[model samples]
Target: MPAEDILRIEGVSMQFTGGAGLFGRRNRTTVRAVDEVNLSVRKGETLGLVGESGCGKTTLGRCILRAHKPSHGRILYRRDDGTEVDLAALSRAQLRPLRTEIRTVFQDPNSSLNPRMTVQQIVGEPLVVNGLARGSEVADRVADTLRRCGLRPELMRRYPHAFSGGERQRIGIARALVTQPRLVVADEAVSALDVSVRSQILNLLEDLQEELDLTYVFISHDLSVIQHLCDRVAVMYLGRIVEEAETEDLFEQPRHPYTEALLRSVPRPDPRLRRRDDVLPAGEVPAPDEAFAGCRFQPRCRYAEDICAREEPATLPRCHFAEDLTLDGVYATDVRQTS
Candidate 1:
C-alpha cells in the first residue's frame, strides 16, 4: 500500500532577477532557481533531496515551507487538523498560523543561531512568538525541547558559540521541534558537521521523527548520507528533478544518466571495488540564467545524442534493474529534473 501523502508540490517554478540598471536601463536577467518541479512526501516519512550546488534542492525545501513563494504552480499542504491548504496561494497574513506547522533547519547552525541569545532564549523564541507559551512556561518548554534534542540543561544557559557544531545543530533542531511542527525541512542540516558528528545528528533526527511522528524533507548533496537516512530519494539537476525512487532502488539501479554519473562519482571505500578505468565527465555546471533547448545536461553528457539536443526528456518509468534507457537509441538523465 502507498503511504499517505502530507505534502504535494505540483509544477512549481521559481525565478530570481539579477544584474543592475545600465544608463537608466535595467540589464535584467532571470535565474530559474527551480523549474516545474513536482513531488509528494508521505506522512511520517523522510524524503531525501539530493542535488549538486545550485540545483534548486534548497530552493524547493524553502518553497514548501512558504519561505519562498512560487512564481508558478501550487504547494498543497495537508495540515495536521485534516485540512488541506494551498500554501503557495496563501498570503502572508493568511499563512501566519500555518507557519507553525512547517519549520526549517538551515545548513549552517552558527549563521542561523543568534549569538546574543542563550540557548533557552533561542529555542523558546518560537513558542513565545507563536503564543503557545509564556514566561516560565516558555523556559520549561525550551528546557524540555532541549533535552529531547540531546542538549544538556547546563548548555541551555550558554550561547550558541559555546557549543560544538553538532550541539549547535541540535539547538537548531530544538528550536524547530519546539513548535511541534508536523513537517520539517532540514536543508543541508548535517552537511557542515564533521563526519562523526554528522552521524550523531542524523541519528538524533531519526529518533525525533520516530518519537514525534514528524515528517521530514532532508536536503543534501551527499548521496551516501541520503542512502542511509532517506526512505525515498529525489535527485535534482539545474533546477529540475531528474529522478525519484525508493532509496535502495535508486542506488542499486539508477536509470537516469545523470544519476548514474553521480553514483559513479562517489569514491568506493574498498580499492578493490573501485571503477578507476571509467571515464569521468568534465565541464562546468551551466549558468542558471541560460535556457536550454532540450536536455540541460547535453553539453557534458557522454551519452547525449541528437535527440537530447532538440527535446527535453520526460522521466519515464523504467525497469528498476536497468541503468540504460532508450530515447531514440539515446540515454536520458538527473540529481533532479529535489528537483
Candidate 2:
C-alpha cells in the first residue's frame, strides 16, 4: 500500500446464496455481485464507482464497509497510527471499535434512516453507541452536527416523515458525520433528489469533504454527476471494472467499449451541445448465471469481434475502430488512447 492510500481492496469477490420454495430448497445458482475487483482509495480523495443497475457498484461499496462479508480476498484499512488491518478477517467484536471510523450514507434516506426515531436520537445514537458522549453532551453534539448539515436544530425533535427528500438526506449526512468517520460510502446519495436539489447536495458534500478531510467511495450511475464530483472514476460492467482512470481522462477519452457506450448515453445539459441520435445495442444485459467464457460485454458491444467472443480483452490499453458509431447523440470515433 502506498503512504497516501488509506484503503485497499484486493481480489474482493462477493456471492450471494439463495433458497427457493417453502421447504427451504437450496438454489444452486450463485450470483457473483463483485468478482475479483481491485481498488484503492487515497486519503481525502473521492473515487467514483459508476455502472448501470445490477452492475455490482452497491455490492462493492458494501463489501468495503464490511456490511457484506467478502467471499474471497481481503479489504485492508490503514489507520492514522500507521497500522493496517484486514477488515474481512475482523470478528464483530474487533470491528466494533472501527465502526466509528467508517460509515455509509445509503441511497434512500427514508429506508435507511430509522423512521421510528426522532432526528436527534437518530444522529446522537452513534455518539452513545461509540461511548463518545452521553445525555446532554450527546444532545449538544447532535444539535451541532444538525446545524453543520444545514438542518434546523429545532427539527431534531421531528420524525423523518416531516422532512422533504433533501432534508431527509441532510439528516442522513448528519448521522453519518456525527460519528466523525474518516471514510464514507455514499451509495447514490443524491440520485433520488430533484435536479435542482442534486447540485445543492453535491456542493454540500464537497464542502463536507473539505471540512472533514474525508475519503469517499461515491457510487452512482450518473456520469455527469460523477464527472463533476469525483477526482477519479472507475467504470464497472457485469461485476468487473472495465476501466479506471482520472475523471478528465475518462470523459475526454474513454478506452473501454462499455465505458464509451456509457459516456455516449449521457444526456447533454445544453440542447446546443446535443449531437445526432446514437445507436443503442440490442438485447438485454446477460444473466449472471450465463457462464460466459470470454468478455461478458461481447453480446452487446458494437465493436465486438472474433477475439472478443473467444477471449476477454484486458481493460488496459485502448482499442480503435475504423468508423465512428453514433451512440445516443455522442460520437464514438476510432482513436488510440491510454490511461
Candidate 3:
C-alpha cells in the first residue's frame, strides 16, 4: 500500500500586519508571508520546502508546526490513531497534546538552545512539560536521546556553551526527537553547521528517521541540502509553491520556470558540466504585500508571456507555459559540496 498523507496543508496562508510607515505616521503595512499553499506530506517521507530567502519557506513550516496560526485554510493532520484534526482551527489548549506528536528543529543552534540549561535539562524539557516523564526518567530519556544523536550521555550535565556547533545541533535534534514526534518540521536545521559537520547531521537525521519511522518537513533555501536529504521537493516563490515533484524528477526535469532558475543557481564543482545556457532569475523579489493578478513569478520568469500577467495558473506546476517549457534542472553534476 502507498504511504498515507500524514499532513495535508490546504490553501494555508499566513499574513502579518505591522507598524505604520517610516515616521510612525503612515498606514500599517500588511505582509503576506505565506500565501495560499497546498501540500501533502506522506508518512516516513521527507518533504523538502525550498526557495530563496524570504520566499516563505520558514513561514510555511511554522504554519505546519502551528507556531503561526494561518490566516486562512485548513492544516489537516492525521494522528497515529487515524483521527484527523484541523490544526489551523484548534485552540492552544486543544493543540497542546498534539504538540507532543509534532515537533520542530530550528535554524540557529546557539540561539535555539537555552544558555543556562544543561543538555539534560534542554532535551528533557519537552518530556517534562508534556508530562511524559519525570524525575530520574527524564534524565534517562535525555541520555538515551543524546546518545542516539551521537553525543555522550556524560555530557548531559554540561551546558550548551561547552559543545561545538555540530554537537549543539545534535542536542537540538535530541530535543525535537525526545517527544517521539511523528512529524518533524526542521527549519534550516543544518544551515548553520560547517560543511564537514552538515553531512554528519544529515546522516544522523536519516538514521533517526529510519529507526523512528519519522516524517519530516525539511525547510531550506539550499537546494544542495534539499537534494541530499529529501524524498520530494516543493519549490516556493513569493509565498506560493510553484512546483513539486519527487526529488530526482524535479532535479532532472523541472517544469516550472522558477524551479528551473533555482536549479540553475546551484554551483557545479566540476566546471565541465556547468550549465551555461541558463540565466538566473533577475529583478528584486517583489515586496511581500505586492498584489499579483496572475503568476507571482511573472516578473522574473524568462518564459512568461502576456497571458501569464493576466491569468493565474492553477496550483499544479504553477506556470502558464509549464507544459510547453522544457526547463533545465540540475543535470549530471553533483551539487553537494560535502561528501
Candidate No. with top TM-score = 3
Q: Model 1, 168-243: lDDT tens per residue?
A: 9999999999989999999988889999899899999999999999999999988888988999999888898888
- TM-score of every model? 0.91, 0.90, 0.95
Give lDDT: candidate 1, residue 335: 21
lDDT-sorted candidate list, best first: 3, 2, 1
- For all candidates, the clash counts are 13, 3, 0
CA lDDT scores, all candidates in order? 0.83, 0.84, 0.90
Candidate 2 has an lDDT of 0.84
Candidate scoring better on lDDT of 1 and 3: 3
Q: After superposition, how far is residue 245 of candidate 3 from its true place, in Å?
A: 0.4
Model 3 poorest 10 in a row by lDDT = 330-339
Which tens-of-lDDT digit does each residue in 1-339 have in candidate 3?
124899999999999999887798888878999888988999999999999899998989988888899999999999998889999999999999999999999899999999999999999999999999999999999989999999999989999999999999999999999989999999999999899999999999999999999999999988899999999999998898889999999999998988888888888767556564545777889988899898998888777789989988985798877888777778745343443
Better of 2 and 3 by lDDT: 3
